[model samples]
Target: MNFIQKEFRHILRDTRTLIIMFGIPIVQILLFGYVISTEVKNAGIAILDLSKDQATIKITEKLTASGYFKIIKNLNSFDEIEEAFKQGNVKEVVIFEINFDKNLENFNSANVQLIADATDANTANIIVFYTSSIIQNYVNEQNKTIKMPFEIKIDERMLYNEELKSSFMFVPGIMAIILMLISAMMTSISIAREKELGTMEVLLVSPLKPVQIILGKVTPYFILSLINAVSILAVGYFVFDVPVTGSLILLMAETMLFILLALSLGIFISTVAKTQQFAMMLSMFALMLPTMLLSGFVFPIENMPVWLQVICQVMPPKWFIIIIRNIMLKGTGLLYIWKETLILFIFTAFFILLSVKKFKIRLE
Candidate 1:
């Protein structure tokens, strides 16, 4: 306990450690959550209303009122759409054919053209989807007033993320990656630095048991990791509008379990690495790459090769991401995430046991 206090005092005195431990998490969360969103809000679009009819006007009003699109240009000619696209301000162009209302009245169908700037395929796709859905809803409402032959209806619903906000997906993944990087990488480097500076030998010679020394070394990082988790959650919630739909207590508990797993992995790395640089290299290759790539952070695990899927199943971050997404997005209870929680607990115990065995071997 005294040794833990000494370690805490030492960490408090180190300004650089304090800043890196706390400041980086806040900055990274704000940058990723607020600045890098994929949600389409007030997207610029051009409208070519060839028929100056009430139907087209009503549809235009509905589109604008939906809050997903902004009509920046009312193009007089079909040629203007390419210019709007080239200008880079418009993501999509909606063109109503001549006699749009006449076609609907006589033939019960009208042609409407939607041209999207496919330069950014994903954003363009989303813009087109929103526009089409709005138009379809308007058509459905109109059909209710007057019976129409050969009616076609398509209904699309997005689950978990009704708004289709990328922040909803990115926030939990960022939390997992950042927590793993800070806890595992930082702890490994700190311990390796002690070895490099010959402090480990002195600590071994002290009255403190090996387990106590190890616990003391990791206790401060555990607390800092908890603070970081709360800070990231707060930033994600307040700034980016990411919600913890499930129990907040459950979320924090899972976060702490993941942190312990990361710290154990860090301790194991420190045991193998004699220098800070080597520990950092190990942590990067071992933790960061897998966390970012295989843990379903930026990509889906099911999309990977069969062997890669098998490999990612073993990654702690992969499970942590699943747990977080289930809690935050799906609003699932502990029942839904208990399997993942158990996997993380198992990983933490395995890493801790392996690290203890390694430490004992080193002492012997």
Candidate 2:
């Protein structure tokens, strides 16, 4: 009983410890609730209109108007189509046969070739779907226009990001959350370890101020987390050809912010836990679970329960994943993500202030 009291008193005396105790779980909960998603949107596409006939033009217009694809370029020839794929701007290529209209009029079936980049197969499948749907709709419209009894058929031209790219689709999100767990949450707990061990007192008694001590502990982890983020990105890029479309600097900056936010949250947990085991349990249940479940990092938030949906609003990683996807996949700028960035900043600032306030109070 006496030893327990002493331990409790020590924990109470350290404000940083208390902050860590609460911060990690809250972050986890929010992460699980809102950010991760599996749905596809706004895929980049290219067209090689070899036919340039009324049928081909009509189909192209319908595909673009479907809102699922954005035409980034128009290829002059089949040779240029390959170059576009290599450059990575085009995810799928639509090639119209030279005599598409004539063949359709005569044979009642025209062949179109869809060449998908295939590197990220999941997105490719969705692209195929969107493109095929547009073409099918065009054909149906033509049948109605000419009053043909559907004698003519539409051949599918689909490639890459095929039906089995689920693994690749989830790679970015999995990497983001796992690295977050290993880097941000783990670093915070490790730093707070000194508090649980009574070694924090020795450091406090030294010439080092509290801020310096914490910074020194967190610095190494910051470097390591950034490295992990980069490594994961490299694997996703070179190994998977999921090239980043946005500014590299912006991606790095957002990653740093998310890491710092998660680290700060871990620091808050350390302040509250009296032992390493408790700290770890809290981090796993609170940080890891929600991050994996809610942040759309693994599962879709739209599919979660209503209460879980409301709870996800508080998670920081959810926003981070959103920012990452926006920049990496959509190639969007800060203008598109400014609101999310502000939310992350607010979370970071709030936790930092709360932890600092608790820390100062503990000194008294």
CA lDDT for candidate 1: 0.81
Q: What's the lDDT of the predicted structure labeled candidate 2?
A: 0.69
Per-residue lDDT of candidate 2, residues 197-266 (tens digit) = 7777776677765566556655655665676677667756664456699999998998888878877777
Model 1: per-residue Cα lDDT over 244-357, one tens digit each: 899999999999999999999999999989899999999999999999899877666766799999999999998999999989988999999899999999999999999987
- Every model's Cα RMSD, please? 6.3, 14.4
List the candidates' TM-scores in order: 0.74, 0.58
Where does candidate 1 clash, by residue pair?
none
Alpha-carbon runs more than 4 Å astray in model 1: 38-42, 46-59, 62-68, 72-168, 361-364
CA lDDT of 128 in candidate 2?
69
Q: Candidate 1: lDDT of 181?
A: 82
